[model samples]
Target: MKVRNDAYLKAFGENLKQLMAKSNKNAETVAALGGIETKQVYRVINGEHSATLSIVYAIAKGLEVHPKELFDFTFQE
Candidate 1:
């Protein structure tokens, strides 16, 4: 079944992609750090699959950022 919160996954994927680019890291490296497969990283980056809490935490730890930061998007007043 598809995830109900697809937008969250999409946003998270975009943020992860940006973070990876900023860190000059590739999918293989990130996946290794996260203990996940490169194909899983590709799926997350492509927004074709949803990330579990464990994966999210791993990514946050790998990126050296708080997991909450991944969901922090401000709106203009």
Candidate 2:
């Protein structure tokens, strides 16, 4: 089956990448801070797959931001 990431997921990924860029940290660094795998961070950032709610929260926690902030996206997807 051919499946694609949902619009909201894609939007979240874009927002995550932007936040990561603004954090001035490398993927490895963010992954460590996010308590996730480095490859997973890249996968999410690259939109290879949809991120789970847990991941969303984890990422926000890693960034020292509120989960609501992650949802503050332009929703481009």
Candidate 3:
């Protein structure tokens, strides 16, 4: 299925990518830590889907950062 793209999603995805790079981590690793499927991580990273609150917390845990960090990006909506 094709997921819709929005400014919020795009910003979140970009931040996720940046965090992944800075942490020297991959989708597989994050997924394992977050207890989610690798594809899910990719979906968020690719800006193809929006993550739920739980997923956001999980991703934050995987990234070893606070949940607020993930949302520390500019968005208009």
Largest TM-score belongs to which candidate?
Answer: 3
RMSD of 2: 2.8
Question: Cα lDDT for residue 5, model 2?
Answer: 42
User: What ranking emerges by lDDT with the best candidate at the front?
Assistant: 3, 1, 2
Candidate 3 residue spans exceeding 4 A from truth: 1-5
Per-residue alpha-carbon lDDT of model 3 for 1-77, expressed as tens digits? Answer: 22334777888999999999999999999989989888989999988878999989889889899999998888666
Structural similarity to truth (TM-score) of each candidate: 0.73, 0.75, 0.86
lDDT of 2 by residue, 1-35 (tens): 12334666667778887887887767787778879
Tell how far residue 55 is off in model 3, in angstroms. 0.6
Best by lDDT: 3
Off by over 4 Å in 1: 1-4, 74-77
Tens-digit per-residue lDDT, 25-58, candidate 1: 8888887887877888888878787878887777
**Model 2, TM vs. native:** 0.75
The lDDT per prediction is 0.75, 0.74, 0.88
- Which TM-score value belongs to model 1? 0.73
